[model samples]
Target: MNALAIENLSHSFGTRQVLQNVSFTVAEGRMCILLGRNGAGKTTLFSLITGLYYARTGLVRVFDMAMQANPSAALAQMGVVFQLPTLDLDLTAGENLRYHAALHGLPTKLSKARSREELSRLEVLDRIDDRTCALSGGQRRRVEIARALMHGPRLLLLDEPTTGLDVPGRRALEQHVRDLCRERGIAVLWATHFLEEVAADDDVVVLDRGRVCWAGPADRIAPELGVGSVAEAFALLTGSP
Candidate 1:
């Protein structure tokens, strides 16, 4: 079964309709990159998937569990890193992870061991005991990612995760996420506007004006759009006339 699935999903805020007939799936152990411009309903989709907001219509399934009917179950089977950081700036990185562990009902011993391993894997072990507010943007982002994995979710949802990082920082975080897909076989649904973040082998889904315009392999999009780069391909597909 697919790790994440959505069918004809639609949502709106009063008069403003956001997502319309959105449909997609993320196969187990694969990465799906969600591409869209600003105000394209990326967050809206995330909200629906995570149960922060209910969709006006359609289905959102995570791990074969329906998000609307059983949001807690669906969420427990997944992890999330929102576009905005949710870290407790006043706490140390280790403390932050501990808090997350408790929130997820994880066993203390197991959570601690996993926290140490995750921080090391993300290359932030040296700062585990340091206050989160003392870290740089990239460092904080990494911690948030590590915390997301505390429950060992089968699927990871990241919304504009590389937004504020520099070139190298962005590259590092991207590689880390890809590594998660490769090593742990965790499926990732990465939402972003930057084409550079899309890997040549990754699956691509383009959202334009609250609708999905294209959904296929990244390489396939380049040829279809008559473009050499993903950015240009996106423009060709969703650009203004």
Candidate 2:
């Protein structure tokens, strides 16, 4: 079964419709890139899927559990890292992770063990006791990701996770997340505007102004749009000049 699914999801604020009939799925042990520009309604789509606000129309399912009807069950199976920074700067990385694990009612020993495991996987185990504010941008992002996985959610949702990182940092973090899908069989929906983040093997969903302009394999996007490269296809589909 797919780890995440959306069908005909639409949302609006006042009179402005932000998402129109958005639909997609991320299967187990795979990564799906949600590609869109800054104003392409990617964040809004995340909001709906995460239940920050329920869409008036359509459905969101996590492992066949309806989000609106079975939110607790659906949400329990998911972990999310939003675009904005959410770590408590005063706390150490380990503390932040412990806090999250505690929220999920994990035992102390298990939380510590899992915290180490996740931070180690992200190559930030050495910084475990350091205050979050002192860590570099990349380190913080990695810590946040580790915290998100404290409960071992089947579906991992990341929105602009590499934001504010340098080139090497961004690439390293991206590679780590992709590795998680393979190693842990965690389904991932990674949202990003940067074309370089998409790999040939990934499933791709191109969102433009709240609508999906294309959906297929990463390598297939160019051919499907009749363009020579993914960047060219993005420009053509989104009319980005």
Candidate 3:
């Protein structure tokens, strides 16, 4: 089953169009990478999906439900980690997770149990009591991810999830994310500009100027298109000459 299906989605800000006829399907249990350049309308698209910005036209469905008509229902099954850091700097990771759990209205006992499991899964259990400000960038990101998963969302959305991490950090987080998707069968929509995030067989959607230019498996793209990696493929597909 498709976890997310967007069709003919269009959005605009006054005279400027942000997305036009954007369409794609993210299968259940699959990890789909959304690739685009800065100002390519990735954030705009996510806003629409999350119901932060109503779509001017077209339809967006999450877990097979219309997002516009039932935002709460759709959101209940989805978890999102935005590009920017959202944690409270002074709060410990455990405290941050507890706050998120309360916000979601999960049972306290269940929330604590799930939070512990998630933190361990992300390899941040040891740092659970440490303030977010004191944690490394990658460790903090993991905490954010763990918080997102506390609700056991069926679909996960990440925007620029590995922005500041070093090579090892990025790879570690990638493996963790991959394992989470496979083990939990959660559909993932990972938005990024980096090529390393594009695994050999992963599906990719390339957006340019707010439109989808390509949607297929990473390994199948032309060698020249991907060039050295997926970022290069995105550049080539978007007409970078």
- Tens-place lDDT per residue, model 1, 1-241, is 7999999999888889888999999999999999999998899999999998976699999988998888889999899999999999999998999899999998899888988998999999999999999999999999999999999999999999999999999999999999999999999999999888899889999999899999988889988877787888898888833
Q: Model 2, 1-241: lDDT tens per residue?
A: 9998899999999899899999888888889999999989999998888899977899999999999998889888988999999999999999999999998889999999999999998999999999999999999999999999999999999999999999999999999898898889999999999999999999999999899989988999899778899999999999997
lDDT of each: 0.92, 0.93, 0.89
Where model 3 places Cα greater than 4 Å from the true spot, the runs are: 223-232
CA-only RMSD, every prediction: 1.2, 0.9, 1.9
Give the lDDT of residue 209 in candidate 2. Answer: 89
Local error of candidate 3 at residue 51 (angstroms): 1.5
Better of 2 and 3 by lDDT: 2
TM agreement with the true structure for every prediction: 0.97, 0.98, 0.94
The full ranking of all candidates by lDDT, starting with the best, is 2, 1, 3
In the range 1-241, model 3's lDDT, one tens digit per residue, is 7999999999999999999999998999999999888899999999999898998699989978999889899989898998899999999999899899998899989988888999999989999888999999999999999999999899999998999999999999888889999999999999988867888878899999999998988787657463666656666788774
Q: Cα deviation of 9 in candidate 1 (Å)?
A: 0.9
Error of 2 at 235 (Å): 0.7
At residue 49, give the lDDT of candidate 2: 88
List residue ranges in candidate 1 displaced over 4 A.
none
For candidate 2, which ten residues in a row score worst on lDDT? 216-225
Give the Cα error of residue 20 in candidate 2, in Å.
Answer: 0.5
